[model samples]
Target: MRFQRSAVLCLLALLAIPAAAISQTMDYDRLDARLTRLAADEDMVGLSVAVIEDGRIAFAKGYGVTEIGGEPVTDDTVFRWASLSKGVAATEIAILASQARLNITDTVGSFKTSLRLPGGGEQRATLEDVLSHRLGILPNAYDTRLEDGWDPAKIRESLKSLKPVCAIGECHTYQNVAYDSIAEVVEDVTESKYADAVQRSVFVPLGMATASIGRSGLQNSPSWARPYSKRGRTAGRPKEKIVNDNYYRIPAAGGVNGSIRDLALYARAHMGLVPDVLGETALDLLQTPRIYTRREQARMSSRYRGTVRDARYGLGWRIYKYGEAGNRVVGHRGAVEGYRSFILFDPDRDTGVVILWNSSSRQPNGIGFEVMDMAYGLPFHDWMELDTSQAAAGH
Candidate 1:
């Protein structure tokens, strides 16, 4: 009888071990000190960071000022999402797919009949093609045109003028205009504007109150971080100056804005905490690797190359494989003229990080990875130190 009791107690203790580890508090004090020092060193105007662990927000805080000697950034301070909008847009589209409103495999030209490849006959690009960056469209072929006030319709009409750099589904080429065509596809399917669809489907469901899409969204925001760019060279110790550019024309590509707090909810949804809001199937589909994005290895800083074994593009997220076992990390990074943002999550560990900055710099990515490492209790790397070294070496 004593042996049985001892065995039961031992089993209970063993069962509590995993739960205890999962519930452990992260070293927020260390993170805070590091972020404060890095912001000062990098001349960052304002930054917001949030970490999700065990399917909930574990830590979230803002650093620095919204502008030079301006308002302090808070959890609710909105910032331009830039290309991070891609992940949000993809999530909404996946929701539509879950409801059978549209099939991701459906040819994009089926809805936007005007959009055609170079030959202009049968549409070779499907909805997945555009979402996964496998449309074979040359990178940013018409991004300048979109930025110059050209409407998405005009860009769609102009598709015939541009040729695919590679065969459809054969190569990965990042795009803005081509991906924005998903907006038109969504509009055709829902008979509503893209922003409205996103607001109704994604923001409302996720309770992301401060999240909005496009120029009007930012303008109407009650509180938002002012856009700023580093004044001189990338490595120069310079001040940040306020700057602005309108990207509403390509809303689907890079036009969403939200606060770090709101983004934490989105991250939680992706981590499978809110399955009823975003179906598990849809979430899986959005994150499942679709095409090899060879650019990640070459584009990422050399410091991260040691851990990142492979990379791929999913529906709207960039999937990174770290270590030999290839630990899965799904995330997206965004860069507009004056803003930089990143959101990274590990589904296996149910850990995620969101970093939004009003200033454009490579520091956010390194900081995000460090936070993730901390969440998983992995060996720490001094990313900021490496960043400083790279900058001094003119890398």
Candidate 2:
């Protein structure tokens, strides 16, 4: 029985296509078919994906519906970027730094922001520290308050009272509410709203026409995927949820919405392909490995652990040493209450994949790795954990 089950799982992972053929080239047609199957297998509420190859969008598609029984999702369907907005904040800050408008090395206390570290730690924390999530306070310090109707300003003000867990720059602490402090920095330096600064610095210049900031940016979209949650009993589909504006309250941390196409262009810009918009110096600073992320390394699956030997955090990105070849892949994953997103790109090859879904399901996370593994000509490892899933379904 065990051997038979293993055989079935292998066939499912291969999806009737040989591993060698799958790795020979970045096959978009095959990828589109595979994504269709994967979305059905995962019962996703809505999904949109874009692949970047040779410095351009090679494949972009959508699967499922905007809502359970509503309109079908298309490439133009807008989905929330969630914490992926961090990369936007980092990129904008880098651009400002290059323009001599603000220096990342400037201390947090130097700016008119509400982030106050214990024992005057904010005096030592720099804009770079905030971007790299080295604030030294507890991880996600005021996220609960931020989610529970507390205004971002008030939550930031309350941070002054919390004791420091580690001194500034001593450890890599992941933050959302605290990380949004960059918004204040951008506002002070640009003398404008953070969203407007991002628009001027990023979206409009990159031709990301569908991209916009804040909750209304998502809700007002003519073709937007409604948020969905997989709660309650055994179900045929996930339940649609109200688009919570809590995360959007922290614009720099979790408030950006766009189509899959916009995300692909954003990734290309980071690869230094869109030089006129983002120069090499700013790109380097945004992606350079700054701190070792031991927590991330521990959380990765055993299969990926062998290939991704090191896990580190850059300005607003996650850097990894992918496969035995040790090629660098910059990527990030994000989750809000009812949405999930993942992006992975190889800067050297100028190849990457971005995925967005309007449900809480995490199944699509592995598709990005599958695409990367094929691009690198590596042997298949079923990064999607389909074997375990098959067992669960009694396949």
Candidate 3:
């Protein structure tokens, strides 16, 4: 009897998919079939996705397996949100500032002691710079080195070393070291660990019970999904090596575990669900364009070519004015080894989406785009997450 029970358990384990390819409606059935076929071809362990429409789940489903060696993704499968974690940080900043706990105008020099920008540019860096990637702080990638006594002084050392390629707002260099510096600020202001502040301000308020700030010592919950990459998605092992990559430094810019559904709830709230979460006033301030990246403006999607309008960059988001068809969309995408994710929303339509994928995402929702369109707007997801927002009322 024990042997039979173990066999049953094993069979059930093999059935896990991170977010299934099965979307919930006939309109999405075509994409559902394609995702089903790709789940096999790509060899994706699992993927879980959801679309927020008219304030409810238009569609939500899981697919494939959870980890390469695990079960399939279910509605509950947890995924590492990667850079999508920025929105969580942005949410905290909004809440704190709304309560007058901190000021967005506070300078980096004010927070971190003993260091100055290589050319003294940081003296001018305000809180807005840290949150918006506008501060010409260090331009390294995920380079946070948190020691036991890591203090404001060391952060200054990090900032003083950045090679200012240009003036503070001149170049929009998407950076992790700079944002992690903001994480340090979050710690200082809240008098809480960065992770703790994130939990209190964003995770808990949104009722995302599964969300976690840092690594856990506890055993893997049944919902935890393994990470996967594009190479691994195609004929490689379903579970790739968990490495000394993205999670090790655990910068504020990254490091949050979540599910597609949970993230959508968080995203939907940005559309004024209860501005009490961040306060409508503070939410408005965070979305304004503080720095515009010339790099992004000069480039156009290959698909759009010559006809593309110069894209714009806001404080924590990419700002743009699309045609009537484009006005309804906004959000961001995140990627790391063995995992990739997308979170976009249609503020005008009160819609949002979270795509928690264990394998490579050929985004703006490659195989996933079709189903995504049915829920919100279209495929216009861009990189850069710090809670990207659309035109909200009054700053």
Which number leads on TM-score?
2
- Model 2, range 243-329, lDDT digits (tens) per residue? 888999899999999998889888877877766678878988999999999988987635465667589999999999988788999
- The lDDT ranking, best first, is 2, 1, 3
Off by over 4 Å in 3: 1-26, 112-116, 137-156, 217-219, 230-239, 243-248, 297-300, 303-310, 322-324, 361-364, 367-395
In order of appearance, the predictions have TM-scores of: 0.88, 0.91, 0.77
Clashes of 3: 22
- lDDT, residue 144, candidate 2: 86
lDDT of 1 by residue, 173-243 (tens): 88887777778777888899989999998898777889998766776777788777665634563355444
Model 2 per-residue lDDT at 334: 91
Candidate 3 residue 77 C-alpha distance from true site, Å: 0.6
Candidate 2 ranges beyond 4 A from true positions: 1-24, 301-303, 390-395
What TM-score does candidate 3 get on C-alpha atoms?
Answer: 0.77
Model 3, span 248-295: residue lDDT tens: 244466677777667766766665554546555765775565665555
What lDDT would each prediction earn against the true structure?
0.76, 0.83, 0.59
Who is ahead in lDDT, 1 or 3? Answer: 1
